[model samples]
Target: MKTLFILFFSIPLLSACSGGASKINGHPNIVYILADDMGYGDVSCFNENSQIHTTHMDRLADQGMIFTDAHSNSAVCTPTRYGVLTGRYAWRTRLKDGVLWSYDEHLIAPERMTVASLLKKKRYRTACIGKWHLGLDWEKDEEGRTLLTRPIKNGPNANGFDYFYGITASLDIPPYLYIENDRVTTVNIDTVEATSGKGFWRKGPIGDDFKHIEVLPRLTDKAVGFINTQSKQAEPFFLYFPLPAPHTPILPTNEFRGKSGTNTYGDFVLMVDDVVGQVMAALDQNGIKDNTLIIVTSDNGCSPLADYNELAEFGHDPSYIFRGHKADIFEGGHRVPFIARWPAKITAGSETDEIICLTDLMATCAAIVGVDLPDNAGEDSYNMLPVLMGEKIAHPIREATVHHSVNGSFSIRQGKWKLEFCPGSGGWSPPTPEVARQENLPPIQLYNLVEDIGETNNLTQQNQQIVENLTALMKKYISDGRSTPGSAQKNEGETPLMMD
Candidate 1:
């Protein structure tokens, strides 16, 4: 009887120990791929009438969870990226208006916590490959002349990325050269004139050997090479690939050009799809597909140029049912594609409509690593790991999310209510633009997103109670430095306006 009792208890305890010693089944390698200026309707998985078939991107959605009402923190590249990295609103920072230029100083302060820095603490090898629109300090010559040859400072290397190979700003911007770590891979001393080369944006200095047409392919190649090199290492890796495609000067490579019947923009989108495919293939080749968490999303909505003659001519509506594009406070401006694929964790062919923001990545990563975030870090990020795993149903992760426009306009979403502080579209059509001030428009705009996803009807007049409630929520969010997770910090400027 004594032997039997000991054997039974010992057997259960040994099993528990064995299970605890085994590797966590769900811990995954994360790959975040960010698309610049990609629209909600750009992918066929999201839009039924999308002219281009993004097979790889579609496959990702099919195999993973697709978020229907996802958003970036801003409608522009730099702010959105800043929010993603810091898990806080970009408007809270000194860069309250506009984006950082290529020659500008580093946007992310050295002291600020970052997703890369957080991941590095967990022993993850982090790398950022592709367009780094977030500003970096480039080295200058003795005469205060900007030298393309000198190494830069306060870039990804300073921000916690073990390796970084990319550009300072948009591909069209000056100091047009590929930066690897702290130095430029290719330098140009002569002032190169901007030209409409292969339908890409023309500006600043570019090497004669640099082909505007091959930007996507080049970035894709670099990403694949990095993955190949890291696969041999023992540490888990994180790759933050921000692609500069389908943005301005849309230039699809020769192979993808004319393939999508939807014109140049559509063709460029197809090229982006190919890039996704290549990255997926690389993961498979390295036998880490099951353990990797690949997330593909965009910085913001489709640009206004995509809505002009090009969209009408090709029967493509980049914003889909949303009212405005890119810089607007409307859903079309900030709502974007968010797809996550983790074969070992997330369920296949699942879709989650829970409102999520790019800002949550930092907290989610922290949760994955079993690391608790300090109060100052990821103030806005809420861990969505439970939602991603399809576990929690009614328990929402984020209570409210704040969005920023190119012109520094602010909008806040809480539950079903969306509150925009400005009257007319505040961004691309600034007060100077023709559509800036609508004669009869109200000072504030409020919409019940649950009832009106298109934002066709303004509820500021009818729903005074909701407007007041959402306004207070927005104010509390902004005043306090964070929206979802941390305590409210007071706003320093004029008291935030309320519609009601």
Candidate 2:
């Protein structure tokens, strides 16, 4: 009787041990999908009045927590990407004034920590699979023929990405061709020509096989292919899929065109939705859906072309009642769509309004993997895992959030109050002849976001005390290299005064 009893207990113990082993080996796969120049209202989940339906993106929101008050650190692509990878504001870097060109050298310094590098230390397979607009040193000769320069350095590969397949800059920009690691897939400068195709830019070496209209579909195909290929590998992977759709040249695939009644921009958004669906399908096909975390967001708000008077007549408000688009230091310019889904960790159909930034992604991933960032790394990132899991209530992750405009204007947000350093709209509007004539406006602007989501009211004169307090906070953050995690850098010169 005693032997039989002991045998029964041993059987259960063996089963328990097997289950524990499986659990120990299971690490969640992570995929971060970032869109370029997509607005808060562009996604149907966030904008009720959006004429177009982003079914896949909306489904993603339904499966995870939707962040209503999320924002990008900068109002443009390159800066926002820098913050996303390094978890530090782009303004702190030497290239503080503007973004880089296609031929520009690597923007990310080798010493700087990146999301891919940090994850690599923890044994994660990292790959950047889409638009890499952060800049890289393209191989070129004096004759202008693309040559094999020293192995591509100081870019994604040097920054910790195990594999990279993308472009050096926006689709409309020059040197238009797919870059696979250190070499261009198809190089031909002789056949290159400058064309004014829709919103296309001039002077680029485009491949003969490449067309401005096919970029979005091609990028989507590459992203889906990468996910499938990486899933077969032994190590769990982290895929940074920054899509090039809905940004410029608004070229949706023929099948997707005219599908949305809104216009070309709307059609482009639909293509983006299809891309999301393809990614999700790939994850499921690989049998890793249950163990993968997928996040979808934008680099910043929509562009002014979506707001050009003719486009606006169709009843599309890219900013969706927010003050400005793309380059302004306002809510419409910086606020963006953020959705994260992890079937095992985050509850489906959840939502949160806590203010968060793309810069926080590095810290959040670090916290999930049970790692701590060194002082120099992720100096601006705040871990949002608790908030994401619906475990925290009312506790704010950030005390203040900083914003940068296209023309290098600055703004700081603390709680509901926001302060902008420049007077007129800090982007294309400022240098315009008509806006320059408006002498009644102050040189600085302040708004209470809680009361003025549209930013129609500027209270710089009425609220002197709030302005002083927020301005001091903003100045301190600017003088310091980062606002949250690291020590402040000592100002070498006289600090800029806090404007009222």
Off by over 4 Å in 2: 1-25, 139-151, 197-199, 429-440, 489-500
Give the number of the best model, judged by lDDT: 1
In model 1, which range of ten residues has the least summed lDDT?
1-10
- Which tens-of-lDDT digit does each residue in 1-500 have in candidate 1? 00000000000112332221112232345677888888888888989887778899899888888888888888888888887888877777777767888888887879888989987876767898878877877667688867677778899999989999887777777766777899887645445667663354555777654666676788789888987876656566678888877786677767986898877888878888888888888877766666566777888888765544566687778887777778777888889888877766789989988989888888888888778888777878888888877896676788888887777777888888898887767677334223545465667788888889877687898889887887788777777766765555533354334322
- On residues 1-500, what C-alpha lDDT tens digit does candidate 2 reach at each position? 00000000000112332221112224555677888888877888888887778899888778877888988988888888888888988777765645777777877778888988887877777888777878786566789754533356566888898888887777767777777777667745444555553455566567665777777677678777877776666566678878776777677777987898877878888888888888888877766665566778888888765544545666667677687777777787789888877776789999888999889988987886778888778878998878867785666999889988776778888888898877766665443213633665566778988999877788998999998998888877777766776666532234343222
- Candidate 1, residue 339: lDDT: 82
Q: Candidate 2, residue 358: CA error in Å?
A: 0.6
What are the TM-scores, per candidate, against the unseen true structure? 0.90, 0.90
